[model samples]
Target: MAQAGTFVFLDYYGRLAIERGFVKPEAEDEDENGEALPSTSGAAKPKVPTISHSAALIEDLTAHKTAALRVELANNPDVALVAVVHAMLLSVAYPYNSEQSALQLTLTPERLEPSMKNAESCKGLSAFNDLADNYGHHLPGNPAELFDWLLEQPQDIVLSLLAFGAAHSVNAVEKKFTDRKKGIEQANQLGRALKVNMPDWFETTGDSYFKHVNRMTIELSLAEARGSEAELSVRAAAKKSEAVTIADRLVAGTGWIPSPLRIAPSEAEQELGAESIAEDEQFPQAAE
Candidate 1:
């Protein structure tokens, strides 16, 4: 497949939108019939100056250096143009940093290499490229245009965001599934390598960890929306946890303490039908 040029569609769409006033007003010469006229009797019509979506996005983002936007950029450095546009909108709507930094990190070249085997990665990149191609033509000069363009987008925008996981997982699955020699062991090996080598790339927080699980459920629910069954698994693995969180009590000793020895149940536990023994399993304690 021929590689698409960066910002080509953005520039083309932006120029079209600007010329047609779909974005913002641009000076145009026209005749009484409302047909665009030549700038000079002998000269042809002047081609409109154009800007890329990235350029336009940066321009719009630069206008709002609000505190909220600053904080969001700090959290998710990968969220380029869209984050800035969202920040500006919030500044107008609530007039404060009502929303925290919710941007996702960018996938750098090094990061990309590890996830290259994941099929979902290709799917995501394809989706982004396709989306950029289609919507690239709908550059909105202002927030209104942006909003309109967003509404016109397919409902799978959310899926696109979640698709990143599946994309990253694709490369791993391919190595295991594609090669004749590779088998289930390859998947296990790749899974372990991914977990250890790229901990930061996967879910590393309590809330984010939960979100990954939820995203897996959502992926299953939207199975038909995804491209294939492989994509479903890729999405699931993308949200998988890399770190093993050992309990404090477990870590305090040899990490081999029995579960029954962990804690003594309170009256609340008995009321809730929760199994409760005692901190020392050998001796039973009365509920206080």
Candidate 2:
């Protein structure tokens, strides 16, 4: 699989092996008898002491907290939207005063052309570009004149522009050797708010998804989307290529998206306020 050669995959597999005790590091400066050898320089070696938490455990705990935070933030879109706008404006209009933005959110838009072939042809990209062009035509050409132009615009227009800019700043793309869990959680929150339907935008075919992954992944996806019968059909294929084809045909129009791409269902807006009030009453300090 093409993904297997990536640094993320390699690092994940290596860490998994270490965590499962399938591999162990060799001790330094020792014989098979488990005795310490003399220092080659005849100098004393300083004692090193250490205390560390399990990286896996910490990651698990923090992930739960991050999920909770995302849910709470999503419950209050009015505040979240304002924070996003404030952060975006500070970064662009007042770069030197960026620290004043309480959110401390950094927006670095990623270019997908290098990684995804024909990325410019994507419908989403085309729509975004058209929106950007429309805004460009209305905005002042000179950077210095932009502030005055923004001030002249109505509240709705300004808010629309703010939303557009904030949307552009979203960076949900994952990278090799990088952690994007928090970014992804926020993106999912935004997706839920917008009621994004991935099936409406993209289709998963052999070229799009199945062919790139291993046969097992294809089988698993087929199982989830089309049931055990479809998975068995794929598994019975003589070659991985054939399996991919079978999977592609079987899963077409099933409206089944990979777990990573699916957005979590949001809680009822009417109940969110009540839940927050109850939590505040139960833990006043935490609410503060």
Please, what is the whole-model Cα lDDT of each candidate in the order they appear?
Answer: 0.39, 0.70
Give the range of the ten consecutive residues with the poorest summed lDDT in model 2: 1-10
The local distance difference test score of model 2 is: 0.70
- The most accurate candidate by TM-score is 2
Off by over 4 Å in 1: 1-66, 70-105, 109-148, 151-156, 161-288
- Local accuracy of candidate 2 as per-residue lDDT tens digits, 1-288: 211121222342354221121211232355677677553344343333334579998999888997887788789865556556656655554446567554668765566667675585566778888887787677655554555556566667768978887776777776676687887678878997798998876778888788888989999999999999999999999999999889889999898878766776555753897798999888778433
TM-score of each: 0.17, 0.55
True-vs-predicted CA distance for residue 151, candidate 1, Å: 5.1
For model 2, which pairs clash? none
Q: State how far residue 198 of model 2 sits from its true place (Å).
A: 1.6
